[model samples]
Target chain A: MSAKQDNSPNRIDTKRLTLYALLVAAAMVFSYIESLVPLFFIAPGVKIGLANAVSLLLAAKGRYKGAFAVNISRILLSALLFGSAVSLVFSLSGGIVSLIVTVLLHKTKLFGIVGISIAGAVTHNLVQLAAAVLFFGGGVLYYAPVLVVSGIVCGLALGTLDFVIIKKIKTNL
Target chain B: MKWRDFYIIAAALLIAAVFLCLFPGSGGKTVTVKQNNETVYTGSLYTDKEVKLDGNTLVIKDGVCFMKSAECKNKVCVHTGKISKKGESIICLPNRIIAQIE
Candidate 1:
C-alpha cells in the first residue's frame, strides 16, 4: 500500500505522462502520413520511418521509458487502425529490436544522434528481413543488400530531421 | 552529422557492398521456385513456363522470372518485376513462395 502512495518513487509525473502521450500521438501521425505515400514503388519495403523520429527524440533526451512506451503504443495503434496482423508482427519485432539497439548505442555516448539513428534504422530493417526469412525461406536473404543500403539512406535522412527537431525543441523540453 | 556518424554510414555501406559482391547476379541460367522452404520447381530461365502455386503465379520467359500474379493483399511480389541474374529473387511472404535465379 505504501508503494502505491502518490509520492511513490515509481509514479510517473504529470509532465512526463503528458510528454509521453504527445510523443505517441506524434508517432501515430507520422506513421499514418508514411502509409499514405507509396514508397514501395522504389522498393518493396523501403520507408522513410518518420514515426521513428519521435522515439529517436525521446531516446536522445534520455527518456528511455517514454521512448519505449511511445514506440509500442504507436505500433499497436497504427496496426489496429490501418495495418493487418501480419504487419503488426513485423512492426512489433522491428520496433522492439531497433529500440533496444538505439538505447544501447545512445548509452555508449560515442556516437551522435545521426549515428544512433542509423544504427536503429539498420537493425530495424535487418530484423524485419530476418522475420521475412523465417516466414518465407533462405532466398529472402538475396534482398539483404538492397535493404541495408536503403536503411542507411533513410536513416541518414531521418537522423538529420531528428537533429533539427531536437535542437528547436531542446529549450522547451 | 558528425565524423562518427560518417564512420557508421561507411561501415554500413561496406557491409552492403560486401553482400552485393558475394551474391553476384550474373551468368545465371536457372530459376528455382520454393514453397515453405521446399523446392517446388526448378527450370531453365530461357524456357518459358507458368508456375501456379496455391495463391501465386510465377512466370519465366526470355531469361527472366517474375510473379505474374498473386492473391495476397499486398502485390509486392508481383511488382518485384523480373529477375534474370543469379542471386536475384522474388518473395511472396503471404504465399510463402520464393522464386530465385540460380
Candidate 2:
C-alpha cells in the first residue's frame, strides 16, 4: 500500500461515529469532574483538563476530524449546560488550539501519549490566553508567564493520566 | 526523553518542593483584589489588615487589602488567614472575588 492511501482517515462509518460520541461523553465527564477538584494556589484559571485525554486518544487513532468534532461538541454542550458565557470563549479557543496541536504533533514519537498530551495542554492555554486578551481589551497578556507555567504543570498531570490510559488501550487503538 | 526521564523529573520536582517547604517563609509585598471580572483594588501590603467593600470603593485598613466581604459558598479566601504575606489571596467563587499579590 502507498503511504497516502495508508494515511487517509477511514470513511465515515457507524463504528467511528459511536467511538467519537463515546469519546465526547467521556471528555465531558472528565471536564465535569475537574470542575469539582479544588483549585491550586498559584493560578486561578488553571485546571487539570483531564477531558483533553479523550481528544488526544482520538487524535492518536487518526480520527482527527472526529476528534475535533468531539472537542467542539463538548465545549458547546458544557457551556450551555453550565450557563457560563465567559467560559465559551476560553473553551472554544482552548479546544481549537489543542485539537490543532494534537493534529500537528500526531506524527511525533516523543514521550508517548504523555508528551503529546503536554503539547496539547500547552497550546490550549495559549489559545485561551489569546482569547482573554481579545475579551479583556488587552494588558491581560502580562499574565502569560504565570498561565504558561500553570499550563505546563496541569499538562504534566494530564499527560501522566493519558499515558496510563493509552498504555492500557494500546491494543485497541 | 524516556519514561525514566519523566521519573527523574518528577523526583527532582518533589525534592525542590520539599526544600521550599522546609525553608523559612518571607512576608509578601504587593496586594491585588478582583471581583466580578474587575480589579477592585491594588496596593502595597506591609502587614495584615481588614478588607471591606463599601458601595463602589473598597477599603483596606490594616496595611493592604483586597476586594472585601466575600459571599462565596466556600469562603476559602476569607478563611485563608490574612493578605499580609506576599502571594496570599482571598478567593470567593460565588461572588467572583480574588485577592492576591503580584
Candidate 3:
C-alpha cells in the first residue's frame, strides 16, 4: 500500500493517529506485564523495561512524535493504574531520558537498532538511579554496578526481539 | 547486531566492571540505616538487631544486613536477602529507606 499523504502540516493523518493509539495501548500492556514479573531480587528496582520496545520501534521508524507521545501516555497511565507517586517520578524521568537517547541514536544511523536500544536501556537505568540518589541520598549509588549489567543484558534481548519484528513487519508507516 | 552495537555493549560492560571493581567485597563491620535522608540507626554488623522505622524493618545479624520486613508495596528491599559488603545497600524507594553496610 502507498503511504498516506499528509495534506496539512498542522494535522496528523488518521492512520498515524490510529497507529499511535495502538502503540500506546501495546506499551501499557507491556508495562503491566513487566510489573508482574519479580526480577527485583537480582537488583532492587531493576526492570527489564519491555515496554520500551514499543517506543524504540516507533522511534526506529522515524516517528519521533508518536514514540514520545506513546511513551509519556504509557508511563502516566501505568503509574495511575498500578504505581505510586514515587514510581511515577522514576518512570517519568527514566522514560523521557531513554526515549530521547533512543531517538538521537537512531538518527545517527551509525549503529543498529540493537545499539540504540542498549543505549536507551542503560540511560534509563542511570537516570533512574540519579533520581533515586536525588531523593534518598548517595547511598543508592551502590546499586549502580548491578543495574548497569542488567540493563545491558536485558537491552540486548529486547533489541534483538525488536529487530526481528521490525524486519518482518517492514511497514513504512 | 552491528559492529557499533558490539562496541556499545563492550563500553557498557566496561563501565559496570569499573563500578564492580570500585566496590569490591563485603568488608564492612557497621550497618547504617537512613530514612528520609536522616541517619536513624548505626550499629555494628556483628550485633543482631532489628531496626523499626516508620514503615520498614531492618535486621543486621551475623555480619550481614538485610531487610527483614517492610511496609512498601513491592518488598524489593526484603527480597534483597543479605549484604556484608562495604558499599552494599537495600533500598526501599517507596518508603525512602536505605539500609547499607558501611
Candidate 4:
C-alpha cells in the first residue's frame, strides 16, 4: 500500500471543504444575528431560522452533506455562543430533523426552495417540541398550538426569502 | 410559483391546522405547576400570587401566569410572556419547571 495517494483528487476535495467551512462560518453569522433578534418574546425556541438559508442553498445545489455540515456547525456554534445545554438539545434535535426533511424533500424534485424550506421549518419546530416534552415534561406540549402557527408563518417568510435569494443567485456547486 | 409548491404549502398549513385543533383548547381555569416530573403546585389561575422554585419564580396576576424570574441562562421562560389562555404554558427548561393552564 502506498503511503500517499494522488494529490489531484484531494485538491478538488480541499476546495469543496474550504467552501463548506466558509458556508459554516456564514451560517454561524446568520445564527448570531438571529440570536440578537428578540423573537424569544414571541415564543421560546422560535425564530426565522435564518441560518437555514445556507443549508437551504446547499441542499438546493444537491449537496446534502455540505448542508448538514453547515447546519450542525451553525447549531452547535450558536448553542455555545448564545444558548445553554437545554437550548443545545433543542437546537440539535431541530436541526437534524429539519436537515433530514429538507434533504428528503429536495430529493423529490417536485418542490421548489420554498416548499423544502417550509417542510424543514415545520419539522424543526415539531422535533423541538418533542424534545421539550421529553426533557421539560409533557406539559410543555401545551405550547404546541402557538408554536405550530408561528412555525408556519416563520417558515413561509424564510422560504420566501430563500426563494428570492435562490432565484437571484444561480449556484454552480 | 409552481403548483407543486402551492400543494406543499397547503399541506403544511393543513397539518398545522390539524395540530392547532388537536392541541388542548382554552377554557381551563386551573393552572398546574410541575417540576422535574413532579406536581409541585396546582391552583386556580384567578388567584394572584407567586410561587418561587429553585432559582425560578412564577407570578400569577389578573388571571395570567408568567415566569417572573429564573437563574437559567437564557431566561426564555421570562421572555415567553404571560399565559392567559388554556393550553398555554411557560417552561423553564433548565429548571425543568412548567406552569401550564389546565
**Residue-wise lDDT of candidate 2 within B10-99, one digit each (tens)?**
643454355345432232245677778788665545323444553222335445454444544665655565455555666666666677
lDDT of candidate 2 vs native? 0.65
Best by lDDT: 1
Candidate 1, residues A101-168, lDDT tens digits: the string is: 99998898889999989989998998998898676544456567888888998888889998998877
The candidate, 1 or 3, that scores higher on lDDT is: 1
Q: Which stretches of candidate 3 lie over 4 Å from their true place?
A: A1-11, B23-102
| Deviation in Å, model 1, residue A161 alpha carbon | 1.0
- Which regions of candidate 1 are displaced past 4 Å? A1-3, A6-11, A171-173, B25-102
TM-score of 3: 0.71
Scored against the true structure, residue A120 in model 2 reaches a CA lDDT of 72
- Recovered share of real interface contacts in candidate 3: 0.63
Q: How accurate is candidate 4 locally (lDDT)?
A: 0.79
- Which portions of model 2 show Cα errors greater than 4 Å? A1-9, A108-111, A171-173, B1-102
Model 1, position A100, has a per-residue lDDT of 96
Give the true-contact fraction for every prediction, in order. 0.55, 0.03, 0.63, 0.37
Tens digits of per-residue lDDT for model 2, A57-83: 777767677788888998999999984
Q: Is the docking of candidate 3 incorrect, acceptable, medium or high quality?
A: acceptable
Cα lDDT for residue A37, model 1?
96
Q: Write the per-residue lDDT of candidate 3 for residues B1-102, one digit (tens) a residue.
A: 789898888888888888667644333257889999999998767556789998988887767888888887789999999988888999999999988877
